[model samples]
Target: MHRTLLWLLATAALAGSAGPPARTAMPAPPPAVGEAARTGGRPWPVPGTPVVVRTWNPPATPYGPGHRGVDLAAPPGTEIRAVAAGRVTFAGPVAGTGVLTITLDGSGSPPLRTTYEPVRALVRVGERVAAGQLVATVETEEAAPAHCKEEGCLHWGLKRGEVYLNPLALVRGGHARLLPVWGV
Candidate 1:
C-alpha cells in the first residue's frame, strides 16, 4: 500500500509539469550583493529562516542513497560566503541552476569547498577569492530553480577529490562546535 501511494504521488508530481507543484512563493529576491555578500559575508542564515536544508554530501539518497551535500533553507538574495580560502572553480548558470562552486586551495578540510548556485552560478570556473568572500546569491523561484532533485531547499555537499564528506563534521571538528543554524 505504501509503495502504491508513493508511486501515485510521484506520478502526480510528474503530471503537474509546471515544475513540481509550484513550491511556496519565496519573497522576491533581494539585491544579489547585499552588505555581507559585498564584504564576503558571515553567519548569514539564521533561525526562523523559512527554507529547508537540502543535502549536507553524496547528494543522493542520504541512507540507501548517496548524500553529497549540505542544504540550507533561504529565499533568493541571501548572501553566501566562502567557508575558507580557495579559488572559484566554476561559476555561472549551468542548465537552470543559478550556481557557484568554489574550490578552496588549502583550508577547511581538504580545500574549503563551497557552492552557491544550484540555480545560477555567479563566479567563473577559475576565480581566486578569499575566505568569507561573497561568491554568489540565491535564486528567488517558487520552485527549486535548478540542480536539485526536488526544488525545496538549498542542497550543500562537501567533498575532497572523490570523497563526499559530511559538512557538519567539518564545522564540528577538533575544537569548535558551531551549532546548526535553524532559520531567521
Candidate 2:
C-alpha cells in the first residue's frame, strides 16, 4: 500500500506539482524550533533532487524485523513533508537507522523504532498535521545511516490503524493526504 502511494505521488508530481486539495482546518500553530529539519543543511532529505526510491519493499534482516518503511534516495537533509495532517506522536532516535522517527500523533504509538532515531516523536500526541506540512526534518547526521541506500536519503514510512503504509503517495500531499482523523 505504501509503495503504491509512493508511485502515485511520484506520478502526480511528474504530471504536475499541484498537490491534492487542502484539508479543512486553519493552519496549525507554528512548530517548535528544531522540530522540522530545514530544507538545507548537513543532512538534507530531498529539497530539490528528484524523488527516487531505493527499496520499495526490502527484505527483513537484523535491523529490527519486517520491512515497515520505504527508503528514498534523496539528498540528506532533504525536507521531508508530512503525508497527512496529524499531530506528531513521536520523534527521536531509532536504533538501526540511527536517525529520527517522526511518527504522526495517531491512535497510538506501537514501539517500532527500527532505525537510529528509534522512536523520536517531534510533535505532541495531540497536535494537528497539515497536508504537505513539514512534519520532520531531513535527518541531521554527519554520516548517512547504513540502511540508507543513497548517500543522503531517508527511509520514510506511514501507518493506518497500526498497518504499515507507504510514504511516497503522501509526499507533497498525494492521495495519502486525504486521510481523515479526529473526525475532521
lDDT of each: 0.48, 0.42
Score every model by TM-score: 0.54, 0.46
Off by over 4 Å in 2: 1-49, 58-66, 96-125, 141-143, 147-150, 171-184
Residue 182, model 1: Cα distance from true site in angstroms: 42
lDDT of 1 at 159: 58
Q: Count the backbone clashes (under 3 Å) in each candidate.
A: 48, 37
lDDT, candidate 2, residue 111?
Answer: 25
Local accuracy of candidate 2 as per-residue lDDT tens digits, 10-51: 544533322332212212212432232343111222344334
Error of 2 at 83 (Å): 1.9
lDDT of 1 by residue, 52-92 (tens): 34433233343545445556665555566565567878776
